[model samples]
Target: MSKIDPELKKKLLKESQAPFKGLRKIVWIAFSGSAFLGLFIMLAKIASGNELQLNNLLIQLCACIVFPTLLFVDRNKD
Candidate 1:
């Protein structure tokens, strides 16, 4: 029978816990960027006196708010 070293076990455990940390950050950035962009576009439309689309505005607002909030929560989990 073989036994794992403590250091090696610790490293493996840490690595396994967040194997997709980088990927998760990338996805979070992409989604957050798009949410901000959508909010900006909606604001532009309002500034230009275009008819307001309530549903679209709400969706953008939620995305803009929710994504960052989710990221914050995810970070605190670590």
Candidate 2:
């Protein structure tokens, strides 16, 4: 078995990185993914002969890029 204690490894990982950095990153990725999916849905509707609103598609794309980055949120509790 490894000699290092589990708690020690957990503590070491916490100390080595800023807490909540990973959380914020994950949230951003999820937000972007959802936005991309929304845009894709609109495109699919158009392919089926349903009218796709260009503005809505553009808005979704912009939201995917802008929403996640809008937060100047950073892990300050290092």
Candidate 3:
């Protein structure tokens, strides 16, 4: 095999070891997922002809907030 240059190897290692390299991606996914789930629940309730309940809104709000917080905590623990 051809030998890799020392400088190139160092740069690659630095990027690979970045702890928060994909934090933005994770947060984005969490936000979108929470939003989609919340919408789905809302739509299901509408389809069933139930009046929108406070509990439904609370569930969605909690999901949107809790998931991101949990993700940040988990990432920082590493």
Candidate 4:
């Protein structure tokens, strides 16, 4: 293997870190949006006078859990 120059290594480090600066904000937004959507669905059902069904709620919970889990798994793979 060839030795890497110091300046080139610094440049590469900066470039690698750049993409992650906004990643935290993006992840929070995605999670919040999903939670909001789930809440909206539950509220709509209540507003329409339907009984809160366990299956429906379970599905929403699964969606909330699954989405973040997928995001975490994908990010770690990199």
Candidate 5:
């Protein structure tokens, strides 16, 4: 029931990351790190009572969505 094509599999095994397992790990790390940075910055603003920035809001939104989605979606890739 395997879906892989044997010829393509051979070529992929000979090449770098032909199976693409590394991509999921890289994406997860990048997204999670970004989320942590955004959370830290947001806390800093709160601690100082700084004026709200619209771009910061956007960054938090991206981090929240991306991090959680990556967590669930990529859990099975390995």
Candidate 6:
């Protein structure tokens, strides 16, 4: 077999290392948006004096906190 060109080989390696980078970004944005939206809804319920279930409030709070923390960690990895 013929040898591969050095530049092309390097590019291939880089691309392979981060396959689906664009898709990953889109998923991250979607999750983060949903997390924030859930948090907003919870806040609105509180403001309107509607009682919230404990588990749901906890889950939303965790989602709101966890997604951004993960995003921050992922960013600093780059």
TM-score of each: 0.78, 0.55, 0.43, 0.42, 0.55, 0.76
lDDT of 6 by residue, 1-78 (tens): 749998999978877987876676677778889999988989999999999999998998898888777676655253
lDDT of 6 at 70: 67
The models' CA-based lDDT, in order, is: 0.84, 0.76, 0.73, 0.73, 0.76, 0.82
| Residues 12-71 of candidate 5: C-alpha lDDT, one tens digit per residue | 775554456567678788878888887878878878988777787787878878887877
Supply the global lDDT for candidate 5. 0.76
Off by over 4 Å in 4: 1-32, 40-50, 76-78
lDDT for 77 (candidate 5): 44
Candidate 5: pairs in clash? none
Worst 10 residues of 4 by lDDT: 69-78
Supply the global lDDT for candidate 4. 0.73
* Best candidate (score: lDDT): 1
Query: How many residue pairs clash in all the candidates, one count each?
Result: 0, 0, 0, 0, 0, 0
**Which ten residues in a row are the worst by lDDT in model 5?**
13-22
lDDT of candidate 2 over 1-78, digit per residue (tens): 879999999888875776666777777778877887987888789889998678888899898778566434542444
Instruction: In candidate 6, list every pair of residues with a backbone clash.
Output: none
CA RMSD per model (angstroms): 2.4, 6.9, 6.4, 5.9, 6.2, 2.5
Q: What's the CA error at residue 72 for candidate 6, in Å?
A: 2.5
